[model samples]
Every structure is written in structure tokens, then in C-alpha cells.
Target: MSVQRSWVIGAADCYNKNNVGLLIRKTACTLKPDVIISVDGDIIKIRSESTFKNHDTIFKLNEEFDEVTADGRKTKTTVTLDDGVLVQHQKWNGKESKINREAKDDQMVTTCIIGDIKAVRIFTKKN
Candidate 1:
């Protein structure tokens, strides 16, 4: 079977961000690519010192999130999550999500406690 293309698209300083770096490294390790390619500058230097692989292909990014051709043609690219079936997030009629109904069920519990405390105060009559 042919391998699918897994491109890590990000800004020039994406490597500087901890979350972004971890994400890229995690993807690389998970995919286990023979050679890691960096279209940005610092990422290549950073990944080269990593445990994954010393082999790397460094290609400069012509723009922030665009690639230009030899004929000076600019094509815009974007990274996005896989789309799937939409599920209902909010409750119908503005109800809360997964509330503990048991708490509301025990409404009389607080009343009983307050009654007991009042009874004790009445008997003790401490000024």
C-alpha cells in the first residue's frame, strides 16, 4: 500500500511554541517517516538534534502559509481537522448539560437541617 502524505503546516516560528513543537515531534514519531522535512528555518536545526533522525530536508517557506512556484505562482494552503458528523452540543430549551438531578431531588434535606438548627437555638436560648 502507498503511504499517505502527512504534512505539518505551521508558521515560521511554530517550532518556538512548546505545544506546536510537541505536536510536530509527536506526529513525526507516530508516522515514523524516514526523513523529516522542515520548510522553516529553526525547525530543521531543532529536529536535527532530536532522537528521531539526523536526516532532514530543509526547505525555506516562501511566505507565512503559502508556497510559490518557479513561475511566481502563489497557491494558498491550509491545515484543518477531519470533518465528521455533527452532534448536538447544547441541551434543548437551554437546559444544563448532565447535571446531578439527585441534588435537586434532595431539596427537603436543607430545610430539615435549618429546622433542626432553629430548634436547638430555641431550646438553648443563648444570648
Candidate 2:
């Protein structure tokens, strides 16, 4: 399938842990970033607002690619699509994080998990 779509920030939520046994502060709603996604065959390209640094990426499905994080950490990333969701994993410095994204009707939801932190970012289709 090949299609291109633009999404505007709708909302965000975060859940985190301060330490192994400590809960993070209350959910913080921050960083509303616009996004555009294009898919062609097994390749996908993503572009995000500058407010979200290091989010723009292009990769072929099921292949590991080199990527640097917004914080400047070099990581190996691999992306795959399962059912209707895009699942991404990034590994670096002996740690790993995951992001799951799904789009339906007019909205897209992304769930990100790292250590004890989890965040959900929502976006509405831009006309």
C-alpha cells in the first residue's frame, strides 16, 4: 500500500517511574508535534515538527538501521508492521525502547515505552 497523510497533534500523556520502586510524577502533557507519514511498498518515511528533534526517519520494513536519538545517543532501530500497527524498537547502550503506532479513521495513536516510562501521543488527520 502506498499513501501519504499528515497528522496534527491532538493530545499527549506520560507515565513514568523515578526509580525501580518509585513512581514518576503525575502525567505531564507536553510536546504537541505535527507529523507526516508516507508509505511505499516496504519503505516508510516520517517527518515531524522541529519541536520534536530526531524524529524524522526513513527505513525499510524489517531491516535494522542506524539512528541517533534526539538526545544524541546512537541507536540501532528496526521497524515492522503487524496487523494494523507499526512497531519500532531502538537499542543503544545496553538499553532498548519501543514505539507502537496505529492509525484508524481520522486519528493516529502512538505508544512509547522506555524503562519504566510510558507515553501516548495522539494525532488527528490533517485535511
Q: Tens digits of per-residue lDDT for model 2 on 9-81?
A: 7887754542222221331344566788887787798877745343778999899999875545689999888
**What is the lDDT of every predicted structure here?**
0.22, 0.75
User: How close is every model to the real structure, measured as TM-score?
Assistant: 0.15, 0.79
Considering every candidate listed, which one attains the maximal lDDT? 2
Q: Give candidate 2's whole-model lDDT.
A: 0.75
After the best TM-score superposition of candidate 1, give how far the Cα of residue 75 lies from its true spot, in angstroms: 0.8
| Candidate 2: worst-modelled 10 consecutive residues by lDDT | 18-27
lDDT measured at residue 108 in model 2 versus the true structure, 0 to 100: 88
Model 2 vs. true fold: TM: 0.79
What is the C-alpha RMSD, rounded to one decimal, of candidate 2? Answer: 4.2
**lDDT by residue for model 1 (26-91), tens:** 444343222122323332211222344344322322222342321233434222112221111112
What is the lDDT, from 0 to 100, of the residue 11 in candidate 1? 13
